[model samples]
Target: MGVASKLKDGFLSAFCLFLIGGAGFVVNVGQLLALVILPFDRHLFRSISTWLGSGFMIAGPFLLEDWGGCKFSAYGEQAPPDSKVLIVVNHGTDMDWAGGLSYLARLGEPFPGGAKAIAKDTLMYIPIFGWLTYFLEFMYVKRDWESDKKTLTKQANQLGTSRLPFYLCLFPEGTRKTPKKHAQSQEFCKKNGYPVLNNLLYPRFKAFTLIAMTMRDQIDGVIDATFAFEGEHPNMSKSLSRKLSCRCNLICQYHPMNELPEGEEELEEWLRNTWVKKDALLDEVLKDQEAFCSKQRKYEWKQEPLDYTKFFALVGVFCFFLVGLSVLMIVNKIIRRGVLVISVITWVAVVAALVINIRPSKVGEKKPDPETSSRRKKAD
Candidate 1:
């Protein structure tokens, strides 16, 4: 084709993508609105989450590094619908959080209702999604024993009664992954006689002890999520935000909710052994799926698909938000000192999404279609 035609085609494609992304945003906002009015409605959130998830699934291919091959597999994928879960994972990079969430959504699971995270107190104020995550029932820790104990107690009581499923994702390494951090964790495990694995930082058992005691009756199962990036990036930091044009791997092992060991001594031993086993399991899974880990899974669903007409209903809402964000950006430039406004908009978007996603915490509130559970099973 001639230069003019080529330019025209490029513009058209860009324009079409913009419109598609814009439409997705509007549907998401409406999904959020619908959730807010029915904040305690578990059924509503599941349906809305599916739509929003599809939006992300569609956009992810464009924005995330390899949108196609992200893999999620689980150990004990099945648990009682209403059971409370304690999720332990290796925290390595910024993409860890988003990658985990994306895998869960694809599995057709909304994160536990009122799920808590053992996170730095400052995460609540993070520029984009951090602010939104703040309102969820999180246990903010000061990285000290005494303070964490008190905070965990208070949040546990609150979460137990919220009637929503609760989960606390902990990073045993206490920070992002690095060669130094990984090496140190390995040393700690070796001194304790634990196996070495390429999966995550050395697992810390202290927090696990507290979690067992704090939510004893309420906690039903434990999940160990092992994350690994595709390709030969030295570490996660180097690969993050760079185009991942292929799928990533998230290997999850679901340990069925078991009784907390009887004695303090036994519990401690259990924690030590669990961490060692988890590391080994991850090594095997990663090795087997090295290539397919970055490839997409094929699953068939026989449900009613989205109504595009209904999806388009909220186009105006998305446009309004986009314009507002754009105007705020322009104002920031004019004020010269208002660069923080961009951060503010991002914060609002992230928080609003979480709020829209809230659901009942109690058991038997509503059971999502078993299909979602099955989809999640594959991802786990």
Candidate 2:
């Protein structure tokens, strides 16, 4: 493509991204208001969340598929929506997660509903987007094992026992692949007497180890999502603009947790071997995209046809909010920002305090009957 065409596509891609993102920001405002339902009725809170969060994310796929003309071919067995999944992807380009959402839509998994991802702690500080993710139940970590271990344990416990089924997506690579990071990975491998990977970084096994052990019994499926693009991996601009004939194909595999060896050391060894396998998969697909996209497989998952009604309704809701909030913020800047900020801050502080203070129920510990407690108090 010529430079002019590239520039035009980039401009258009960015504009569309903002439109969708803007709509999402507006929806976050509604999520903010919906916090009242959370304390009184957990079921209603989840129902509201499905629309405000996951329902809003449906636009991501529509923007890519309808506007950008990108097609994602998915291959694997995905757990039913009612079942629990732990997905570890070989994180590649910037849009990997977004594109994967297209495939998740195909597999009948919740878009971002109960589909929780581990995000950087920094994301929580962003005004609208940050507040939205916090309400969506995203887990944040700073990558320090000391503090992160506690955060993971505390958060995982909530999902571990919930009747709501969730698909927890993780990137064991810890971060995306880049020239500098790849060099570091290579040096670390050499120092540690491990084989160097040509296509993937050495897996960081800490978070995965802890998460897997904690949710092992509840986990229904462990998925490995391997992605390869037809051309050089693209950022949101190129990917959204569908430049370079950029196409993504994901070949996912399901492994039952009980089938794998249960020990931590054994699990680490299994992960080492898994990365070696992913390296080979990447090497294969780089040579031929057809290696996976067109190949026959045990399961062939089709993309769920775009939900135009839900998509437009979500975008429309935001558009409405945009106009209303614009005037409200302008007319009442002090009151608007003050109320929004205080509500979010107080809610976050309270939740953090509760998570820190709450203790997990002890296994096999008998609970005192409520009636008995009341009777004993009366006698006392």
Candidate 3:
């Protein structure tokens, strides 16, 4: 966090943005090529696009190196490889979902195949990315409440039909992670005399119950991925961009998302109870960290060569390179007439990803919360 480090970090951030944009351009062209040449299986395309996105996700940490002290650990029974899971996680930053996916890759899980997320519709309209992912069949939701409910119902049905093992990652808190929200969550849990460590931002459960009930038959289990960032302060996410380079850890414990009850009221109660236990488990993890040895036990971390996969790794790199060059030329020569320095810088990133052809991964916030809302308010 020194001045030099801050300057270095700023440069890196700008570089990452350029690379992200360049990557998007390349990925778009790649998807288009796949669509035209790869016979006509919509399923195959979706799978490939998803895996491609995962690859981009994997490349992010290395290229950006914004996350510091990042870790992903699991609890309860680990889902069988390729099993469909409904993953419930505490959302802490805009990057939390992506961070979680990267974390999953480290845990030796098939990050892409098992992943499908509910995203805002507006995001789908964002140039290359939004279009390609939308075409590939990611779930898109309107910002309104009623529409989101209907969309959740539809997503459940889609999950049942899609046969591809899928896990839905939802931020029941429905927003970025913040200390105030975390403290509020803690207060709610304590006032109800519920377990204190299941401390999370207040979870809005309307759609959660629906998704669980709809996909009950297909879902192998419900994963409560409690993400805890170990640091010295409670306002971990307020300045989330700052923690990307500091030490951070995430404890993701998976518990069986029990069978959804038949009655609506019972189901709500069931979901609430499930969260209460999650709170306690979160507390247990936090306490253990406080008392544990300096040399913490290293959870499983695995990496494999991407080229082993069917054509994906090779094709993705080629596409990244091609797209980078094309964008650089277009922006420098035709579109911006070389006036936009940002565009020129982004092109360089695409070139780097192609030349290096390396990918690294991890997940979650990089700071610690000192107290939940209930505790913080009292201390003040």
User: Which candidate has the highest lDDT of all?
Assistant: 2
- Model 1 Cα lDDT, one tens digit per residue, 1-380: 69996676566545543544565555445555666745587555545544444443333222233322233232234345655778777665555555545444333334422345777665555332333244344667766778878887787766565555545677766677666667766776678776675666665566777777767777787777666555542222222223234334555656764655756678677766666676676566467665344342322112222223332444455678768877887767664445576556865765564443221112112347999999999999
Better of 2 and 3 by lDDT: 2
Candidate 3's TM-score: 0.68
User: In model 3, which range of ten residues has the least summed lDDT?
Assistant: 356-365
Candidate 2, residue 1: the lDDT equals 83
**215-258 per-residue lDDT for model 3 (tens digits):** 77777787766665555422223222334432334445554546
Query: In candidate 2, what are the lDDT values of residues 1-380, reduced to their tens digit?
Result: 89999888878866675666666666687787888988897667766776567666666566656666666667766655577888888877666767767766654435555667886676676655567767777789986789999999898887676666677888888777777778778888999999799998899888888888888888886888888777656465555576535566787888887776777888888888988998998877766767655663446665557664655676677678668877887789796888689768955764464343222212122468999999999999
Model 3, 292: alpha-carbon shift in Å?
5.5
What's the lDDT for candidate 1? Answer: 0.54
lDDT of each: 0.54, 0.72, 0.57
Q: lDDT at 136 for candidate 3?
A: 49
Runs in model 2 deviating more than 4 A are 1-11, 240-244, 296-299, 324-380
After superposing candidate 1 on the true structure, give the runs of residues whose Cα lies further than 4 Å from its correct spot: 1-76, 107-115, 190-199, 228-242, 245-247, 285-318, 322-380
Q: Of the pair 1 and 3, which is ahead by TM-score?
A: 3
lDDT of 1 at 105: 37
